[model samples]
Target: MTSQSISTDVYEQAAAWLERLDNGPLDKLSKRRFINWVDAHPTHKQMFESMLITWSSPTLERALADAKQTITLKDHLRCTPAIRWWQTAFICTALVIGVIAWQLTPNQPSAIVHQYATNTGEMRDIRLEDNSEVTMGSASDVYIKFSDRHRLVNLKKGAAYFDVTSNKQRPFEVKIGSASVVAVGTEFNIDRGQYFTDVVVHEGAVEVAGSRDDKPVLVKAGEQIRITGRTLGLVQSIDISRTVDWRSGWLELDNESLHYLVERLNRESAKHIRIDSPALNDIRVAGRFRLKDPGQALNLLAEVYGLKIEETAERYTITRLP
Candidate 1:
């Protein structure tokens, strides 16, 4: 290929990697591989770093900045439209980079594990090789293991809503902590929360197994289950639609702790929201907050709950009102 063609390819590849990182979580191995890709070519590093800096705040500029730079990315990554360079690159990157990442081997072993994750407050929708769909929530990591035997998606952290396309020969399973959720052509939401793994089935039934010694419990549609570590908890029925509201860009809280609510609200914004007093952490809050304006919601919370908010360019802190 010509020099221009090669340059285009490299720029495109770098943009695609940045896209994957933004669209979903970048696992440690993938992240390392990306760093290697950046290091191998100065152009790759420049494009990647520029795109990263454009989308994220100034804080990440240092992290994405290369030790020794070559070309300036202002010409390639950004356009005169005042468009966000990184956002465009991210959504478009997935269209390419298919052949580079995953290749099917005749003898697929469990060793071929692909890890994916998202940053704090970022949610992603990704499709698996088997056509299974995964919607990942913020601060989440997923390990995908597709072997000759079975297809597994391990929710290492946070939450994911799975829409499995049926394959009788290979059952779709999601591993959370020590528990495994098994399903066949089903739709369900699994949340790896701070204390427990919450499961809600929407379309089909799933067998939830916490431990090898424990019996696998069948949780059907409209049913919910919670487990922590390797221990099982009670199965209850819930409104599946109401629970997965975050997918639609709304956070519904009903007497939730102030600390927890603050965390969720923070995810919707670039600003870090902190509770000034530990005592305020346990204060219960109830409301339906829209993701469109998290700061507005925070202000409303402060006003209603008698909380004081302190703002800075870096972050926003919430303290009890005198």
Candidate 2:
């Protein structure tokens, strides 16, 4: 099949998956199968992520299936070379809609800006005057600046989700580390790690840049872009549900590094969790683990990987089981 046909088919399948998920809870097997489907194609995950954001309203349920119910996506392709993006976002918007990052850069001129933070093992949600919403992950810190000129959120550490209300006149912007993501009206996620910054666009589009001199790259819905100390990295597809699963108090991993996973989990725990072996970073991990109970999550990790856990007065250490 042509690439256009393939894209349509993926959207159709993504709509079906979103419908299934909305109808009921997703079991482990189903979640695993879904992950495999996303892994099957890079764009597949991005498409799914986009759908997740578009379907945020109750009015949009089954919007995708209905869009092509009698008049299927394939039927439309018979006439047009490709479907329009607004139509795509509209159809996909009715698919995965549900509920809806960062750092500290300088605070530009503003009327009144504020700071928000989440404590260890805490998650907080904030609603801004512009109807924008922000969800901060554990131990995250951010600064907000709202001026007549622009909307800004500075993420110093941890992660956050920005569901920005549209205002073409005042574009929404996020600053994390040395990176900046700008959007007019959109929903996106940003993770400012110690080493790198990750940005995922669940809806709308984003422009990412390193600093003033660095050129910006556009990141559309269903796509993700990342960068470290350098300028913008390559934009890529992402699994939206997996990316923001923390919103539901769960962490979903797909062969993710144990060390990396520990680093995130550490933010939610009073005592830091450390890995003695760097090779542990290679261990493939999967499944949905809760973030509320770090102890339970760590215990499951130890059991799953057959690793020894040494709990000292000051630290929690993980090592290969003897």
Candidate 3:
């Protein structure tokens, strides 16, 4: 038969028949029928071979079978051409309905924007997509993106100490509030929220820029920048290692008040704690303690200064007895 005799509808019907017969053993009559169909036209043999190859290929067959049920029959037909008009008309309507249903269904959120959170008194170390490392503090969340042009990370809440790998071509940038810190091959801490943007540069240098300003300040080792609104100030000559001690599972309390220390402990301790006496709030506590055991730290605090520890339904309160 001539190519004109082989219509698109005919080819589609033959393809569908091949798909149906994909797994079954071919009988003598069935083989003869197939041969007769192929001989009907010059294009018929070519079309049958194409369909047979498609149905037999492991990759194509597996993909077709695993395809969502919501897919329209017309879509499947459209992807492959056929030789008959009547068969196309028969499958077109069902295919159209399937396409509509699939289109209307909501898709899940993209893997790129998925958010991960850490609870209070917890610290988690995560390796980012760009081969950088991050150790997040209590109640923190972060996301990463490694696009063609640039590498980026969004620290949604709380603080995190970052050991950024060097990528001079595409400098690493961290955003906290309206302030941001950009660096290349550096270690830094960003404590951010609505109230403040505190950046402590441990190694190398960070270019600090406020969202409203045209220029940024270069903060090097032993320096920290605290920004609130458009105002920025520097706290000079601070020990960088002390600031990053939390990564080693230690809370370094250097000339910090008991009230502030307790607050830090609440973030580092799994159990809730409280301060009962107002007088003890201003008392200074200095030293480093293992973050793994807040109870041991509390005991050390009580032993060093003859203090009393009490428990309530709400929290574990520490007081100074007269």
Candidate maximizing TM-score = 1
Instruction: Report the C-alpha lDDT of model 1 over 292-319, residue by residue, as the tens digit.
Output: 5778888888888888889999788998
Q: Candidates 1 and 3: which is better by TM-score?
A: 1
The alpha-carbon deviation from the true structure for residue 121 of candidate 1, after best TM-score superposition, in angstroms, is 4.7
What lDDT would each prediction earn against the true structure?
0.67, 0.70, 0.61
- Quote the positional error of residue 41 for candidate 2 in Å: 51
Best by lDDT: 2
Off by over 4 Å in 3: 1-111, 145-150, 191-198, 227-231, 238-244, 277-283, 303-307, 312-314, 320-322
Ranking of models by TM-score: 1, 2, 3
TM-score of each: 0.62, 0.61, 0.54
- Candidates ranked by lDDT: 2, 1, 3
Instruction: Kindly provide the TM-score of model 3 when superposed on the true structure, using C-alpha atoms.
Output: 0.54
For residues 34-61, write the lDDT of model 3, one tens digit per residue: 5456446656655554333212323223
RMSD of each: 13.5, 19.6, 21.4
